[model samples]
Target: MTYETILLAKENGVATITLNRPPMNPLNSQLFKELGHAVDEIAEDNSIKVLIITGSGSKAFAAGADVSEMAYLSPVEVYNFNMGSRKTFDKIENLGKPVIAAIAGITFGGGCELALACDFRFAAENVKIAFPETGLGIIPGGGGTVRLPRLIGVGRAKELIYGGEMIDAVTAEKLGIVTKVVAVDVLMEEAQNYAAKLAVRPSVAMKMAKESIQAGVNLDSSSALNYENQCFITAFASEDAKEGLGAFLEKRKPNYTGK
Candidate 1:
């Protein structure tokens, strides 16, 4: 589908959704709608094993939500808008395929929340990330408050959210927010290469593992273990599992059908 605020491309089992607004791809209602559509497209395509999300220009993955549009919104309108954004982010988080955020330059507020939804975040050396909503007389309404604490410690999450200060790529990595940091020129390349690697793995196993991890996050140890065991059984029953095991015994490469 053609999208005004984003570009979607699929290649070699890896799909990329680029936020097309240049300079700083600020998230707006239109962009959020387009993103939701793009995500739906990716989710339905069985051939697409992984997805990478990034911004068009090198200066920013996304600056934040479009404040100009948001400024005039009424409280009720804002609540609805925030809920829509949260739904989109939640969809990305729950997408069966692994999703990677290729972050560069300014990533703040809603942008930071978006990255938090992805399974992995690959930031460029020039990346600066923060949740600066507090300065705007609000808090993160896009699952940031919930997910950020789960990612980083609660104290650190509170510090970042309350202070609304940006952190450099190095600091973000040290804080475990960024999976890896690379040169600006190679940021997309790194993300693509990693996505390609994941694309070739057993899709069923990957999906099961992702689901297990996500679901286990909210469960207690015993319940989580039980859920994980169920996921393992589901993966073990797939055709790919048979291929993988047979290939291992036969000393040959496994050709997964993503079943």
Candidate 2:
């Protein structure tokens, strides 16, 4: 598909989606529409085992949602826009395959929320992340309010959201917001390598594990454990599991076909 706001490239079972509105890659309605289409394309491709999302240039992962697009909208229009973005981010977060956010430069507001939707994140050492929505007389309408607290605890999420303060990569790493932080030049390389590693794993098992973990997080302990056990058995029944077991006993690496 032709994409104006983003670029999609696939190689070796890994698909990378680059936000392409140069400079800061501000999120606008068109960008969100293209992103939804991209995700749908990825979802239909069986060979795509993992996905990576990042923005163009080293200046920013994304500065924030396009403020100009929001400067003068009716309340209904704002609600519609928020819902569209929320749905896109939710699709990313709950995708059967793993998703990684390769972040660099400034990541604020909706940008930060977008990264939070990914299963993992790798950021450049100079990355700055924050939710500055409150200062704009708004709030994170893109699932940030729910996901941030779940990721970094309620107190910390509240503090950051309420103050609209930005934190550097090191602090973000320390707070568990990013999977890892690397030098600016190696940010993409690191994230791609990680995605490649995940892509080679037993696909069915990996997807099951991801789903189990995500669902478990929101359920009661007893219910979560029961659900996890069911997911485990489902994975155990896959052909990949047989291959994994056979290869283990043969003292050789498993060649999973994603069966």
Candidate 3:
């Protein structure tokens, strides 16, 4: 299907999905539905090994869901809105392929939630981001209350979510909200550089590692180890593993087929 709100490009086993809504780039319900479908397209394409998400303009990654749209929602409409967000967020979090969020400018509320859903995040030096849900007489229902706390800590997450204030990129990196930061001029380049490198890695191993880490986070030590062992076995069973080891012994680069 043709997408008016986003752009998708794939090359060298990397797919870049750019949110194209202009001005403040608000995340409306339609955008959420399109995002879910786009992410699924990227995930199902076996030739794509890495996915990078970013904004089309330099002004805002996404300022949040269009607040104007939320002005007159009933309880059922609110439920539907949050459910769409959760569905799209799950698309990111559960993707077998690694997804990197490239935040260049303002990212708040649902946008923050979207970035958090990705496996990795790279932001510009002075980029601004926050939750700001509490200030609107509601709470972060798009997994911000849950995911933010997991990334940073309960204390810091609570403080940010409670105060409804923005944080700079450096602070976000320190708080674990972002993995790295660069200048605004080179933010997308830097993020794409990292993503390109990841694209060449063993896709099977990356998928296994992601699963292991995700499972480990919500389980006890013993249960986590069991999950890791299962992932380890799965990784070893892949064609990439055999090629990687044999190529290593032969002093050559291993080619993976994502088998």
Error of 2 at 125 (Å): 1.0
* True-structure lDDT of candidate 2: 0.93
TM-scores of all predicted structures: 0.99, 0.98, 0.97
Please, what are the lDDT tens digits per residue for candidate 2 over residues 171-214?
Answer: 99989999899999999899999998999999999999999999
Clashing pairs in 1: none
The per-model lDDT (C-alpha) reads 0.95, 0.93, 0.91
> Residue 37 deviation, candidate 1, in Å?
1.2
Estimate the overall C-alpha local distance difference test score of candidate 1: 0.95
RMSD of each: 0.8, 0.8, 1.0
Instruction: Give the per-residue lDDT digits (tens) of candidate 1, residues 113-204.
Output: 99999999999999999888898899998888999999999999999999998899999999999999999999999999999999999999
| Predicted model with the maximum lDDT | 1
Candidate 2, superposed: residue stretches over 4 Å from native: none
**C-alpha RMSD of candidate 1:** 0.8
Count of clashing residue pairs in every prediction: 0, 0, 0
- lDDT tens digits, residue span 53-138, model 3: 99877788899888888879999997898899999998899899899999878999989999999999999886899889899898
Ranking by lDDT: 1, 2, 3
- Candidate 2: how large is its RMSD? 0.8
